[model samples]
Target: MGAAEHRQSPVGVRGAVAARSVAVHIAVLVDEVAFLLRPRDAGWVIDGTVGMGGHAEQLLEGSRDDVRLLGLDVDPAALAQAAERLRPFGDRVTLARANFRDVRTTAARHGIEHAQSVLLDLGVSSWQLEGSGRGFSFQLDESLDMRLDPSLPETAAGLANRLSESDLARILAEYGEERFARRIARAIVRRRPLGTTSELVAVVRSAVPRAAWPRRLHVATRTFQALRMAVNDEPGALRQALPEAAELLAPGGRLGVIAFHSGEDRIVKQTFRSLDPRRFAAVEPSPLTPGDDEVRENPRARSARLRVLERLP
Candidate 1:
C-alpha cells in the first residue's frame, strides 16, 4: 500500500471529518457490469482500469472465495486507493500500476495466464477531477496537467504551448469532436503558453461566440478532453488493449466495457464487431445506459454506456 492508502479514512474523529468532506466516487453501472461479467466459481478476473477498486470490490464480494482478481491502473494514486479498498480480500486481490494497453503483459508477469472476466471502465475518475491538481475538471482552476499517469512525458499545458495551430485544430476536431476546432486552435495559438485551467477556459470562452456557447456543457470541455486524450493516447491504448483482452479471455469468458463518450463507444463497437465471429459473440446488440435513479444520484454516470462480448467455447 502506498502513502495515500495508509491515510485512508479510519474510525476516528479526524477520519470521520475527512470522510465527510471528501466526495466518494460511485461506481457506475455496477449491477450491469456484474450481470455481464458473471464471475465464475474459481477463476481469475482482470479489471483493466481499476479506479479505487469500486467494480473490483463488488466483483470480489459477489463472487466465490476461490475467485481471484488482477487489477491494473495507470495512476499510482488510484492503485493506492484500490490497495486500501481491496485489502480485506487478502491474497485473492493483486494490484499493479500499469496502463490497460499492456494488460496482457502485466497479467503474464503476475502469473495470470487467462482471465474468466475482463472489465475496462474508460474515462476520468472523480478523484482525478476533484482532488488531483491535474486539471481534469474545467470548473477547477488548476495547472494544465491532465496526464492520468504523471510519468507520461506530455502535459496539457505543453501541448497548448507547443503544438501548431493546424495540429491543435486537428486534435480538437478529431478527438474532442469540437465544431469550432479551427477557431479555438487559432485563439489558443494567439494566446500561446496557457499555464492554468482558468487561462485555457478563458481562451475557449473568448474563441467561441456567446450565442454558440453550449447551455449544458462548458465551452472548455472539448478542448480539455482533446488535450487529455492526446497526452494519454487513450484511443491508441484502447485499440491495442481490446485485441489483447480478447486474446487473454478463457473460453466463454466475458469482456465488459463502460465507455463515457461517443469516440470510445464507437471504437468498442467496431472492434468487437471486427473480431472473429466464430470465436466471439456480442452479448447485447446495443449498449446499456445508466438508469434515471443512478444518473440523479451520480450525474457523472449520465454519459456511461456499457457493452459486453463473450468468447466462444
Candidate 2:
C-alpha cells in the first residue's frame, strides 16, 4: 500500500475525515516537530511519544536515509500503526513499545546515547480517540476502560467505582481542572455501578446545571479527561519523562513537548524553569498553538500547546 493508504486503513474509522486524520491528515504537523529538533548535526533523535509515527516519519523523510529515529509508545496499537507508518524509513526508524517515562532506557537500548532532539507529544493520540475501544470519550458508549495500555490492572470504571469521592474530586479538580469536581464525584459515588462512557456522561450531566454546562465546553469533558489521566497516570509519567529527556539529550540538543492541558503545560514550564537557565534556554517561552487554519481543518488541534527547550553545548 502507498503511504497515504497505509494511514487511513487502520482498525476502524468513525468518519471520512477522522479516518483520514488517522492516515495522512496529520503528516503536516511532522514539520512542526522537526522544526523544534533543528538537528544542527546528523545526530540521532528520539520521539518519546511517537504516536502514529506522524512526526517521526516526517523527520526521517527529510534526513539522510541513514539518520536514526528512536520512537517510543506505550500503546501497542500506536506502536503497530507507527511501524506501518514508518516502514518506508526501514532501519532508520526504531519503534519501541514502552511508555514515555521509560524513554531514556528505551533510547539507550537502541544505542541512541546522545540524542540531537527529543519530541514528546503528551496525552492521547487521535487514533486512540477514534479507534481504541478504551472509552476515552463521552461520545462513545463503550466500556469504561480508559487505560492507554489495556495490560494495566485498574480501568476507568474501576477508578470511578473504587476511588474515594474526595480522591476522585481531587483528580478531577487537579488533573482535569474541572470546577465542579466535588459535585461530579459525589454524583458518581451516589450513582454507583457506573460501567460505560454513557453512564458516566449521564451522571455528570445530571449533576451539573444546564446553564453551567454550556459555560464550559461539555459537562462530561473534564470528567473524561480526569479519568484518562488517572487510568494512565499521565502526570506521573510526564514528571519522570521530562527529566529523563533532559538527561538523555546531548549538549546543545533540543527538547520539545506538545501538551494539551494546563496541568501539563504548568509541569513543562516549571520543570524547564528549574533547570540550568544557561544550559537550557527556552525556544518558545509561550507554548505554540495551532494556527487558525489548522484548527479550522482539525478541531483536535485547538488545545495543543508546543514548548521547546534546548541544551547548551
Candidate 3:
C-alpha cells in the first residue's frame, strides 16, 4: 500500500499533526480533482483520466450518496493522490492505475461495467507539468522526460534525438499539426546532443521565423507536443479509449471528454460522429469551452473543450 492509503484520516488530533507536515500534498490532491470533473448526473460515473483526482472530487461533490465513481489514471503518483482525496467516500470510490484505453477492463475491475456518466480530461496534470522533473515545459531546462507513466522506458529526449529527420517531421505534422516540421526536424538533427527543454527550444527557434516567436507561444511548443504524443502513443490511445468508453456506457449513459488541443478535440469530435446515432447521440453539436472567468483563474484550461454524448436505449 502507498503512503496515501496508510495515512491516517484528518478526523483526530494525530491526523491534525500529520496534516501540518503533509499539507501541501493533501491540498493539491483536493484542489486538482475539484477542477477536473464537473459531475451533474445522479448515477455511476467514471473519471477516465483522473489525474491527481481534481475532477474526481468535483464529480463526487455533484453526486448523491448512491452515485459511485471509478477513477483511472496511468500515473502511479496521480493514483496515489486520488486515493487520498477520495478516501472520504471510502468504498463508494474505486481507484485504478491504468490507461483509459482499457475503459471496459478498468470498469469491470471496479465492478462497474457501465456508467451513467464518463468524464475524460485529457490534459497533462499540473503536478506532471511542474514537479515530474520530466521536460514538459520549455520554461524548464529539465531532462526531456514526458512519459505519462514513469515505468515506461521511452523518454521524449530519446525520441527527439533518435528519430530520423523525415520520421520526426512526420510526427510533428501529424501530432502537432506544425507547419515547420521539416525545418524543425532538420534543426534537431543538427543539434543531436539535445538533452534539456531549453536546448530543444533554442533549436526550434532557429528553425522558425523570428517574427513567430512568443506571438503563438514558443516556436518549439508544437515540436514538444509531437514528441510527447508519439512517446506516449496518446492519439492512438484516445482512438481506442473513446470507443471503449462508448461501448461500456449503459443506455442513457452520458460520456464527456475534455480535450486540450485541436488534434485531440478532432479525434473526440469524429469518434462521436462515427458512433451510430440509433444507439448513441451527441449531446451537443459543438463542445463546450471554458468561460472567460474560468480561463482567467486557470490559464491551463484555455484550450479545453468538453463534448458530451449519450448512449441510446
lDDT of 3 by residue, 1-313 (tens): 3212221221332223223322233222232233222334445788888877766776676566877888889899888888988888888788888889888887887677677677787888778888888888878889988899888888988888789999999999999989899999999999987888888989998999887665746778888888989989999989999999998877766677888889999999999999998888875576667545455567777787777777766
Q: Model 1: residues >4 Å from true position, as ranges?
A: 1-25
Query: Which pairs of residues collide in model 3?
Result: 32-54, 33-53, 33-54, 33-55, 34-54, 36-55, 37-55
Which is better, 2 or 3, measured by lDDT?
A: 2
Worst 10 residues of 1 by lDDT: 2-11
What ranking emerges by TM-score with the best candidate at the front? 1, 2, 3
- How well is each residue in 1-313 modelled by candidate 1, as lDDT tens digits? 2211211122242223223321333598876676567464577999999998888988888788988999999999999999999999999999999999999999999988888889999978888988998998899999999999999988999988999999999999999999999999999999988999999999999999999998878888888888999999999999999999999988878888999879989999999999999999887788888766677788889999988887877
Q: Which structure is stronger by lDDT: 1 or 3?
A: 1
For candidate 2, give the lDDT of residue 235.
90
Which 10-residue window of candidate 3 scores lowest in summed lDDT? Answer: 1-10
Clashes of 1: 0
Arrange candidates, best lDDT first. 1, 2, 3
